[model samples]
Target: MADELKRRLVHASGSGLVALYLLADYLAIGLTWQYFRYLMIVLSVGVIVLEILRLRVGLEWWLYEKLTREYEQDQFAGYGYYMLSMTAVVLVFRPEIALPAMLMLALGDPISGAVSDDSLKRVKGPKVLVTMFVVSAALAAPFLSHAPLAILAAALGATVADGVTIRIREFVVDDNLTIPIYAAVLAWLVLEFVPI
Candidate 1:
């Protein structure tokens, strides 16, 4: 439980990545969209290299043993998937869309995880799902308020990503990778299709 708590705390820190945009812009630190794009590119590439080293070279980090689940020891860890998904979200969506999606990942996932029982194979309980939806909707509302339907869609998308586990042969899809992308894509779709 202590280790799981540590993992969730680290997961919540992802909100700091989204904070880079707000703090930089307001502080006039000159983190322009193009620079952010470049940063994401660098981060994604770096994670790819690190993952290769970890998976292929038998490289082991101390944190890996403490934070990673037994299932993750034989495959890519969640943090690698996390950064890659954030990179994709930052690069593909506008700030209004991207920031909220990132929040869903940074905030919603960890919050839901705190309430979850990892022993379950699938379908988190209603309490966990409700918490995810409420937190996700609240996080997205400030950014997506211009379109109410889009907020619900974004929240629902994030909830589904966090609450369900999909296994593909040997791979289990990580919510770290799916939450932001799914939320962003769904919100984008609603915004694009249903005129406000």
Candidate 2:
């Protein structure tokens, strides 16, 4: 029971980062895109420095241990990937594509992660997919002109990305990074080709 509670807290805490992403999206409308790029760069550098200090000097030892995955103790944590991926999406894609994609990652991935088991025993589990689709679609509705189809495509892509775990040797790619990129690409394709 305690373990379950701890897990929920940790996952929920991670999900809280979504608020920051959403804030960025909101700010993007008013600020120049270049401002976002610079902000991301500063954030990335700050996170990297803090992470290095934490690992090397044992800074904020208790908080770090509590928040970090066991596998990430010796490596950069999910936060790094989150920032990197968010930056990539903002920089690589147009604002229209980037915002929905970030929203899919920010909202949908967390909903799926909180509820679903980590195992791939069930390929593209229904619960996670459905939750992701609903959350992504709802969050994306206001921003997107053709909300239904574009949001559906983004949701589907996010679900697939979240469901699959990619690894290169010892490094496991976090869903935070993959979900937005996949969703953005898929959403963009749908928006471009399909007359919705």
TM-score of each: 0.95, 0.77
Per-residue CA lDDT of model 2 for 1-196, tens digit only, reads 3444464465445334435555766756544667766776787788789888977887776766566667778777876777678778777877777877776765667667677776644255788778887787776676675557887787778877887677779666788778889888888888889987
Q: For each of the candidates, give the backbone clash count.
A: 0, 0
TM-score for candidate 1: 0.95
What is the alpha-carbon RMSD of candidate 1 to the true structure? 1.2
**All models, RMSD in angstroms:** 1.2, 3.8
lDDT of 2: 0.71
Best by TM-score: 1
In candidate 2, stretches whose alpha carbon ends up further than 4 angstroms from where it belongs are 1-30, 55-60, 120-124
